[model samples]
Target: MSTALLVIDMLNRYEHDDAGALAESVGESVPNIRRLLDAARQQDSTVVYVNDNHGEWTADRRELADWALQGSRPDLVEPILPSPDVPLLVKARHSAFYATQLDYFLRTHNVDRIVLTGQVTEQCILYSALDAYVRHFDVAVPSDAVAHIHKDLSDAALAMMERNMRARVCLTDELVGVFGSR
Candidate 1:
């Protein structure tokens, strides 16, 4: 399968990214995200950062990030920036499928399966997975790599995805095998 790692809503925004929850386990997910990133590297898979483009009103995604960080919307999120190598996709709505070029990029890259990792599982993460499933992409969520408004809701979302959408709710440790490295 052509798998891609989708890091969603890890931007500096409260509505989607976990502003309050970061003091808890969100930092813990970073190492795993990094690990998953390395795994994707070995597998020659795509790494896409699906960020909330508070660009919902005006401007574009980069402008949104700049405004959120440099402007008065500091309460929404803290800066959890991605690496330079990671490709970014600005999502105007909850799901990454909302008027975004995610579909086009996936098609161009021949990405058939997606390994989703990001913040606010109850919202952006869940919505993205649902849309991916609907689009007939194999969806997998590494439980340790995502959190929700609360950890409880995170677990619940994962359960729902596994039971309803038939997604694989995996662990970061299990992600090692997906890499093509020998």
Candidate 2:
């Protein structure tokens, strides 16, 4: 079963401080997510940046990046994920599947399993993962690769994924172990 990485809400508006709305929540997971993304790229796996439109119809990604760099958003997304060259950017409001071509992309790519990793585990990630699962796609989330405002929320989100959605809520170290047999 092939897997696609759904990076939800790792956008400039959320991660970057300039966009400012308490989204400064995501921490160190940036590098961890980058590592997994790089691995997916190397393996020829799909890397979908499922981000929020921030309801900015006229918002240019470049403008957002510049504003983020201007120091308004200390923790804003850097050049790592939100790049203009990445042809796989899907903008959304709540769920990544909300009016986004994400489901189409997954179907087109023949992806059955989805590896979810991003910010606000209780909100965006939670909804996206559940949506994917409800659509009959396999879902897995690396515990450390997801960051919430609090650990309890993160844990609860993972619990919902495991209990309700039947997703594999794993830690980074356990991922290799879980995938190594294949």
Candidate 3:
């Protein structure tokens, strides 16, 4: 099964009320996410960055990156910046596939398995997993690579995805192992 790494909503200004705490929570996942990115590149896996436009409909990827870089914590955006070869999709909703060409893009690349990694495990990550599951894509969520706003909600979301969507909930090391062994 061909796999694609979906890095969702990592580019953020963190201007919201709980932005600081969210940033702190997500900070723990950055290293794992970096590992996944490196492994994906080494294994020639498709790397697609799905980002929220933050209500700026006219803003492109560069604009979005620039805005994120100017935020209070540019460090978060710097390391995970999408490489030139990586495709970036701007989404306005929680699900990456909602009103986006993400499904088509994955199909075009012959990707049948999706490895989800990014912020707000209980929000974007959870919704994107369901969307992918309904579309018949096998989902694998590396628990270490996703951040959460609330511990309880994140745990619940992960359980729901594993039970309802049959998503493989594993760690980054296991994911990298699979990527390498393939």
User: Highest lDDT: which candidate?
Assistant: 3
lDDT of each: 0.75, 0.70, 0.92
Q: How far out, in Å, is residue 170 in model 3?
A: 0.9
The parts of candidate 2 lying over 4 Å away from their true place are 13-25, 71-76, 83-85, 176-182
Residue 94 lDDT in candidate 3 = 98
In model 1, pairs of residues that clash are 14-76
> Across residues 1-182, which tens digit of lDDT does each residue of candidate 3 receive?
78899999999988899798789878899889999999999987889999999999999889999999999988888889998779999999999999999999999988899999998899999999999999999999999999998889999999999999999999998898555333
- By summed lDDT, the worst window of 10 consecutive residues in model 2 runs over 173-182
**What is the RMSD, in Å, between candidate 3 and the native fold over all Cα?**
1.1
Which has the higher lDDT value, candidate number 1 or candidate number 2? 1
Clashing pairs in 3: none
Instruction: Between candidates 2 and 3, name the one with more favorable lDDT.
Output: 3
Least well predicted 10-residue stretch by lDDT in candidate 3: 173-182
lDDT of 1 by residue, 1-182 (tens): 67788878766534335455653555667667778877787777788988876656565556655665664334333434555676887877889877889988998988888888877687888888899999998889998887666877778889899998889998989875665522
